[model samples]
Structures are given as structure tokens and as C-alpha cells.
Target chain A: MTRIAVDAMSGDHGAPVAVEAVMASLRAHPDLEIIVVGDADALNKEIARHRKADVGDRLTVQHAAEVVGMCESPARSLRQKKDSSMRVSINLVQQGSASACVSAGNTGALMATARFVLKTLAGIDRPAIVSPIPSRRGHTLMLDLGANAECTPEQLFQFAVMGAVLAEAVHSVDSPRVGLLNIGAEEMKGNVQIQQAGKLIGDSELNYIGFVEGDDIYIGDVDVVVCDGFVGNVALKTSEGLGKLIAQFLREEFSRNALTRTAALFAMPVLRAFRRRVDPRQYNGATFIGLQGTVIKSHGDADAVAFASAIDVARMEVEQQVPERIRTLLAHSLGE
Target chain B: MTRIAVDAMSGDHGAPVAVEAVMASLRAHPDLEIIVVGDADALNKEIARHRKADVGDRLTVQHAAEVVGMCESPARSLRQKKDSSMRVSINLVQQGSASACVSAGNTGALMATARFVLKTLAGIDRPAIVSPIPSRRGHTLMLDLGANAECTPEQLFQFAVMGAVLAEAVHSVDSPRVGLLNIGAEEMKGNVQIQQAGKLIGDSELNYIGFVEGDDIYIGDVDVVVCDGFVGNVALKTSEGLGKLIAQFLREEFSRNALTRTAALFAMPVLRAFRRRVDPRQYNGATFIGLQGTVIKSHGDADAVAFASAIDVARMEVEQQVPERIRTLLAHSLGE
Candidate 1:
């Protein structure tokens, strides 16, 4: 039985949502166990509610004296809230009490806490935030979503290797094709940073495809796309925004008049199907890779189902020993 | 009467589409005059087709012996293709033969030619690529789509002023709210460069709205969004890719089965309305700001209607003397 620690005091709604997700996931997956780490009183009440709802003893509670606020500074919060839920949850993984940890907390705080507690894998200087985005050919794994804002050419090369390893370890791409995110597909395009990174990756023995443009991320043939944190964050956020805008446009246009509304009624199935395929909620889970242990970050506002998705990703990552695989690959590639 | 030059020999299909857009825009606007620049014999044939369509003689042709190929290096092409249609069109703008020029040609070549021919406005160093993206509040103007890969804090400030002026001049936002694009909205967040830039803009006389994340670009509360070329290019390209992916998903979903096809029949009106609002073609024009003369770059794959939108944007910029306004404002802002 694999147990993953959950940061119950994280996110907007906090304990109830994460606790409920644990109960729901436990019911669905008999092999899974979740240790809820938060205020004992608050988590107990949510646990009681799940118990009354017929959830089993697979859900357990662990006390956390403090909770990191969303607006708190990551470094200061780390010092002030030593036993915060986020810190405690990551500590469980550090102590080998849990296979992994999932948190929907302040990203900066979470990254700082996890890094300090778990330490980094050998040969890995800093970890990366890797997530899957749905595309034409299936999923394209993108890394450095908001980890290190400025990455050297060597660091970007490391991210490519780690992303490819993650894709191969979990997503099962035999020779995961990697690409450098750039302004244009041509060799001479992009700034000095990207141009240098592209050259390094192109020389590497890994399945390093040359330059890939922003459009290539969704074009979906490539397996892994690596970028610096700034560019990655912008690309990810813009995609999320555009997705919502498109959905809103469809809803508004469908309700324009009685004729369209009536058609919307009949067309609900097709529209729903379309929405389901492209729904952002289904793509909620993001992994903090290159760390010593698995740490999954769910959206701060994720509901039970989305939280469950994050837990599922945690289970997958832990089972595959993604971090260990990355460490091995990095050591081999860097000859350390 | 305002005269605009069109690069008829550019893009995938070449002269015919640009020529047709001129005919359409001419019929729509009584005061607009368009000069189509391309190979004389080929352009004359396209003009003849429009003539047969009963479009007016407001359309004229200028013969050019050469064309800059899409894949040619901007610098090498600038030297070799002096008589290329792209060069000829911008030359017209420089000589006061046309108020502005619109091209659906190779972007690098267009920007290089425009810079070489029109030169930079006083107090401005490098030009930026600014374009309008439809948003919840109507439209938001975003700058540095892929102009300069890396921008200093000072350069970003310059872009902010120019974008604010454009918003005030063309978009008619009296106190246009400007936002600096970053990974997070908080002041303490982002790298040193953005942090420094944020402080500068906040202290400026313009209506700076602090920091905005990637998602905020689509939310559209800010009238203008400023970013470095690298990040902006990624955001723009990612947005474009996601849009195509969503559209493709909808088409595939709607045509999945017989039941979905019937639903599609009833939902056609709403779907069409939704398509129109988010259509890339509807938002075709991209202005090369910081230049002494107005230069618009149309999408390489733009159709007649899309090309017409670019023409409209060019007309607006030329009529408002956007370049002169930016020059004066830059000079004033710099105390030069």
C-alpha cells in the first residue's frame, strides 16, 4: 500500500476539499492511502464527514501546527512556519513515511520548503515544474513552467534531459523527442540564450530535435518541450486564459437568442464532448521534477476531481521513481 | 486621399489574395487608395480579374522585378533583393508616395526593410511589433510580439509609453491602463529585470496598473500589455497554437457521429458567431512601432477579408500620424 501525504491546509477552500478528494480517491483506488496533514481539528471534521459518507479507514490524519498563507513570502514563511502543513507533508516524503506529497499551496513557499526538506537529487542544481498540455498528437510535456525564471543554456539542456526522462519513465515514450521553445523554427531565430541552448541540445546524443516554435507545443508531434521559466510561465498562462475565453465565447454565443438557445439544448452533447476534450481541469496536475522525491502541485482552486487527478499523477510519478531516473540520467549525461 | 502600399507578391498564395483584399477594402472605404506592388505582368493579370469582378480603379499596380523568398535571411535578402516587392512597397512609404505600407511577406525581411527605409523615430532605438487581440472588454493591444528578443528595463518602459499612446490614439482609451507582463502579479515576484521595470513604470506619469500574469492578457482589464520580445513571442505563438487546437477539437468533436452532426446543424448559428469573435483572421494586422512611417505586417496566410483588416489598421495608423505622436511623446518622456 502506497501512502502519499496531502497538504490539507493548502488552497482556497483548504482541508475539506483535499480531505474529501482523499476519501473519494481511496474509495476508487483500494491500493492507495492518503495521510492528511493539517490542523487536527479541521481535518478530523472533514474525515468524519467522509466516514459518515461511507469512506473507509484508508484516510488518516496528521497534525500540522501552522498553515502557510497564499500571500506569504516563500523564504520568510519557511522560517516562520516550520511545522506548516506544506512543510509537514513534504517532511513525510523526506522521512520515507510517504511515497510522495501533493500540495495546492503557495508555489514559492512549497518549492522552497520541498527543496530545503527533501534536498535536490545529485547532479541536479535546481528542480523544474513539468506539466502535460493536451495537443493534436496527445500530450506534450512542458517544463520550467515557473521554476527558475532565468535559466542558462546548460540548465535548459538539463531540463530537456529531465523532461525526456520523465516522458520516458512515466509517459512511456521510448525515445522522447525534445525541442527548445523559440520564437521561430529556423536555426538562426531567437535570442542569444535560446540560440545557444538550441545548439547545445542539437549536439546532445538524446533525441534532441532542433528548434520548435510556440505553435509546435500544440502541434503535438514532439514529446517534450523545454523552456526557461519566464517564457514557459507566459505560454502556460496564456493557454489557460485563451481556453477560458473560448469556452466563455461558446456559452455566450449559444445563449444569444431563443433559436440559438434551443439549438444549444440539442447540441449540448457535442459541445460537452468538445469541452471535455479541451477542459483545463483535466490537465490540472503539475509535477516539481528533478527533486529528490516526488512533489505534485495542484491548482489552488482545484476541486475534488481535479485534486484526485493530481493525486493520480503523484502515484504514477512515485511508482516510476521519476526523480531517481532523472538523477541517474543526469549523472550519466554530465559524467558526474 | 490616403495612399497605402500592399506587398502583392508576398505570402503563400501571393498577389491574388492581397489584390483581392485591396478591391474589397476599396469598395468599402471611399477615401482609401491602394497601390499593389509586385511583378507588373502578374499584378496586371490580378488587377484584370478584379476589373472583371467590377471593382473600381482605386486599385493601381507598381512593378517590381524581384521578391524576397520567405526563407531568405533578412540581412542577405535586404542586400540582394533591393528591387523586391517588399522593398518597393516600403520605399513608396519613405518617398511620401504612400501614407503607409502593408505586407503579408516574410516578417524578418519586412522589419529589416522598414527599419532600413523608414528609419527609427526620434528618441526610439529599436522598433516593436504591436497587435490587437480580442478580449472580454473588446480588444487589448500587446507589444513586442517578436521584435527584440531581450529588452532592458528602459526598453520596456519605452514600449509602455508607445503602447499607451497607441491605445490613447487609436483605441481611444483616455487613461489607458498599462500592465507589465510577468510570472506573478505581486510586486515582490518576478526576476530583477521585471521587478526594476515594474518600479519604473509605476513611478511614471502613465496609467501603469502594476503587474499582470499571463492569464490577465485574455482577461482584458488592462488596455495595454507590455513584455519583452522573447516572452511576448512565446505567448503570442502559444495563444495562436491553442486557438487552432481548440478549433480543431471542436470540428473533430462536432463531426464525431450522426447524433453530433444533427446537433451541429442546430448549433451552426451559435458556432459561427463564436468563430467570428475568436477568428485569427478577424485580428490580422500587426504594427511595427517605433518607426518613422506606419508599417503593418499581415499574416502570411491571410485571406482577402483578413488582409482587408490589416489595410484598415494601416489606414487608421497613417491617419492618426501614430509615428509622429510616438516620436513627440518619446522625446517628451525622455526630456530630450
Candidate 2:
């Protein structure tokens, strides 16, 4: 049986929606056990909506007195709100009561609590926030989504290695091809950090494909892309913005005239397929890798379906023993 | 009469296309005079292709011995390629032979030669690359596109001032709103540099709107978006890539079947309008602001139409006296 800890008090929607999603997911997977960490009264009220009698055997509630605000500093929250639900969920992973933890709370708080409670994996300096990027060919995993704002060349090289291992383990790709995100394809095109990372990647044993520009992110030319959190966050948000703008423009275009409305009926199938291909929910969760245990972050606005998909991703990561495989791989090449 | 220096040998298509575009632009505006800078031999051959014989009176070729390669380092080229067309173009502007210099060669080389030849205006440490970004709403001018890689908070503040003055001169907007590009909209959201820049922008005399995120670039909420060259380059390229990807996807979607093809035929007018609105050529030419003289960079792949548009933009910048206005604005703000 797989046990997962859900941070019931976190997210924009708070514990109600998170509890409902977990219950729905539980209905689909009968063997799974969920540990809800949050205020006892709120958890009981939400669980009662699903009828505690139906899920009482599969659901367990852990009480926490404090909550971490979305705007609170991560370090301050970690030091002050020791009994917060975010901290409690991470503690479950550290105590080995859960295989993984899932949260939609303050990203910085979760990262800090995870690092302090669960600890970083051996030989890992800073963990990366890795996400599955939907591409033209298929899906590609990218790292440093929002974990480290600044990174050294060695840190980026480590992210490439860790991201490659995660992609191979979760997606079952053999020797995942890695690419360094840069302004240009030339080895000498980027800043001092990218230049140094390029040299390190070229000298490493991983299957490092040469540099890739931002345009290549969706081109599906490579399996993994590595960069610092600052560039990665901007890139991720830019892509999201573009997707929204394009969708909005198409919708407006389709509604502009009677002929377009009639033509939209004929093109609904293709449009629907295109929409699914770029749907944010289809690629919902981002894995917080390089920690001692698995932690997945679902989008704050994610529905039941998206949260369930995140749970599925976490299960795969744990089942594959990705951390051990990465340890072995890095030991051989990185001399850990 | 407005005089412009054109680097006839620059751009991907070379001299003939550039000459053709310049001639076409001249025909549209009878008051404009153009000095075509290139090898005298190549200029005469391309010049003969134009059927209008009297165009010779409005245009003349200046001899230059060398052309800079697109990949050549800007600093090295400035030191070695003294007789290059780019250098000669800047020399013409400095010597008051022309109001502005427009080139389609290597961006770094053009900027470096312009700065070295014309020097920065008083109280300006580094020049910034400014471009007019086409948003959902009309348009907004963004600065530091690729001029300075690393910037201090003070330099960013200066960019805001220069950008506002240029927008006022060219777009005829009074007190254009300036925004700092950051990951979030909150006051305390960005890195140390952004935090300091935010304070400076608030304290400065310009209409400094607080922090703006990546998504805001397309929303057209603010008139001027400011950031370091590294972030600006990433944002610009990412947007360019998305534009191309959307165009390709639209083409594929339209060609999926005969029914959709007929629908595409009916939607052509609306689609074409959308394309025109987002077309990069419509906003060609980025001005290297803050130098003593104006230098604009057209795209490397600029065709006749795009090159002509760049020339028009150059004309607008020159006629509005953007450089002199920026100098006055900065000198007043800094009390220098």
C-alpha cells in the first residue's frame, strides 16, 4: 500500500478543495492511504462532506496548530511555525511514515521546510524544482524551475545530472539527452555561469547535447534542460502567458463573425486536440528533486484530476528508487 | 530634409535588397536623402537595377574597405576594423553628415562601434538597447534589450528616464509609465538588484509603476519595461519563439483537412490582421539609446519590406531628436 501526505491547510483554496481531491483520488485507488496534515476541526469538517464512514478506513488526520501564510518568508515560517501543516507534511516524509509529500502552499516555505526536515541527498548542494514541459514531440523534464535563484556552474551541472535521472526513471527514457539553456546555440554565447556550465557538461559522462536556445524548449529537440531558477521561472511564466494569449486570441477570432462561428464548428476537433496538447493540467506537477525523499508541488488552482495526476507522478518516482539510482550514477562520474 | 546613412552591405540579403528598400522608401518620402555606405563597386551594380534614374540625386555611395562579420567580437572589431562599413556609418553620424545611422549587421559590433565612436552622453554610464514592443493594446517601448549585461540599480533608474524621454519624443506620450521586470508584482518579490531599482524608480521623477511580471509584457499594462540585458534577452527571444510556434501551429491546424481549409479561407482576413498586428517586421530596428548619436539595428534577416520599415523607424527617432531629448532629460534628473 502506498502512503502519501497531503498538506491540507495550504494552497489558495485551502484544505477544503485539497481534501476533496484526495478523497476523489482515494475513490479511484482503493489501496492508497492518505495522511491529511492540518487543523483537526477543518479536516474533520471537509472529511465529513465525503462522509468519514466511507473513507474512514483509508484516511487518517494529523493535527497542526499553525499555518504558513503565502506571503510569509520561508525561513521565518520554518523557525516560527514549527507545527504548521506544511512542516507536518514534510515531517511525515522525514519520519518514513509516508513515501512522498504533496503541497500547493508557499513554494519557498515548502522548499525550506523540506530541506531542513528531510535534508538534502548526499553530495547535493541545492535541490532543483523540476517540471514536465509539454512539447511538440512529447514531454520533456526541466529543472531549477523556482528553487535556487542563483546557482554556481557546479550546481547547474548537478541539476542536469539529477534532472536526467528523474526523466529516465519517471518517463522511462534510456540515457536522457541533456541540454543547457542559453541565449544562443554556440558554446561561447551565454554569460560566465552558462559558459562554465557548458564546459563542465561537455567534460562530464552524461549524454550532454550542446547548448539550446529558449526557442528550442518547445521544439522537443532534447529531453532535459538545465538553468538557474531566475531564468527558468521567467521562461516558464512567459510560456504560460503566451499560451493564454494565444488561446484568448483564437477564441476572440473564432467569435468575431458569423462565418467564423460556423467554421469553428467544423474545426472543433482539431482545436480540442490542440488545447489538450498544451493544457496546463496535463502537465500539472513539479517534482522537488535532490531531497532525501520525494515531494511534488501541484498548482494552487489544480482541480481533483490534476492533483491525482501529481499523486501518480509521486508514486512513480518513489517506486523507481530515483534517489538511489542518481546516487550511483553521480558516484561513478562526479566522484561523490 | 531628413538625412539617413544606410549600411547597404549589411543584413542577410546583402546590398541589392537593402538598396531596393531604401529607394522605395525614398520614393515614398521625396524629402529624404540617403547616403549608402558600402564598397563603391557593389553599390553601382545594385544601383543600376533601379529604373528611376533621377534617384541618384537623392542617394550617393560612400566607399568603405571592410565589412564586419556577424560573429566577430565587437570589442576586437572596433579595435581592428576601422574602415568597416559599421564604423564609417557611426563616423558619419558623429561628423553630422547624417541624423542617424541604420545597420543590419552584428548587433554587438554596431553598439560597440557607436559607443566608441560617438561616446555616451553626459551622466550616462552605459547605453541601452530600446525597441517598440507590439502588445495587445497599441504598443509599448522596452529598454535594455541587449545593451548592458550586468547593471547597477542606478543604471536601471537612468534607463527608465531615457526610455520615458524617448517614448515622449517618438510616441508623443506624456509621462509614460515605467515598470521594473520582476518575477512577481509584489513590492518585495524580486532579487536584491530589483529591490534597489524599485526604490530608485519610486524616488525618481518618472511615472514609476511598481513591479511587473513576465506575463505583463504582452498585456500592455505599462509603457516601458526595464531590466538587465540578460533577462531582457531571454524575454525577447522567448516571445519570438512563441510567436513562431503559434504561427506554425495555426498553419498546421488550418491544413488538417478540406473542411478546415475552407474555414481557413473564410478566416484569412481576420488571421492576416492578427499576423500583421504581431509581425516582427512591423516593429523592426532597436535603437542603441544614450550614445551621442543615434544607431539603430535592423534584424539580420530583414527583407526589403522589413528594411524599409527599419528606415522609417530610424527617421522617426531622428526627427524627434531622441538622443538630444534623452541627454536633456538625464542631465536635468541627475543635475549634471
Q: Score candidate 2 by DockQ.
A: 0.38
Residue A120 of model 1 has an lDDT of 81
| Candidate 1 residue pairs that clash | none
lDDT of 1 by residue, A1-336 (tens): 878999999888798889878887788778888899999998888777755345466677899989999889888888999889999999999999998999999888888888899988876777889999998988999989988888888889889888998899889889999998877622234467777888777777679888788999999889999998888988999998888888888889988889999999999988888878876677878999888889999999999889988998898888888888887787767655
lDDT of 2 by residue, A1-336 (tens): 889898888878888778888887687777788898999999988888786666658889999998888888887898999999999999999999998989888788888889889888887898889998876677678888878777899999889889889888889889889999876412234378888998888788889997777777777788999988877877788677666776777787778789778767766766776666567786877898999999988887777677778777777788788888778777766754
Chain A vs. true chain A, TM-score per candidate? Answer: 0.95, 0.93
**Clashes per candidate, residues 3 or more apart or on different chains:** 0, 0
Fnat across every predicted model, in order: 0.81, 0.32
* Model 2 / residue B169 / CA error / Å: 1.8
Residue-wise C-alpha lDDT for candidate 1, range B1-336, written one tens digit per residue:
889999999888798898889888888888888899999999898787755344466677899999888888889878999999999999999999998999988888889889999998877778999998888878889988888888888889889989998998888899899999988622234478888888878877789998888889999899899999878888999998999888898899889989998988998888988888888887899999999889999999999999999999999988888988887777766666
Question: What is each candidate's DockQ, to 2 decimals?
Answer: 0.67, 0.38
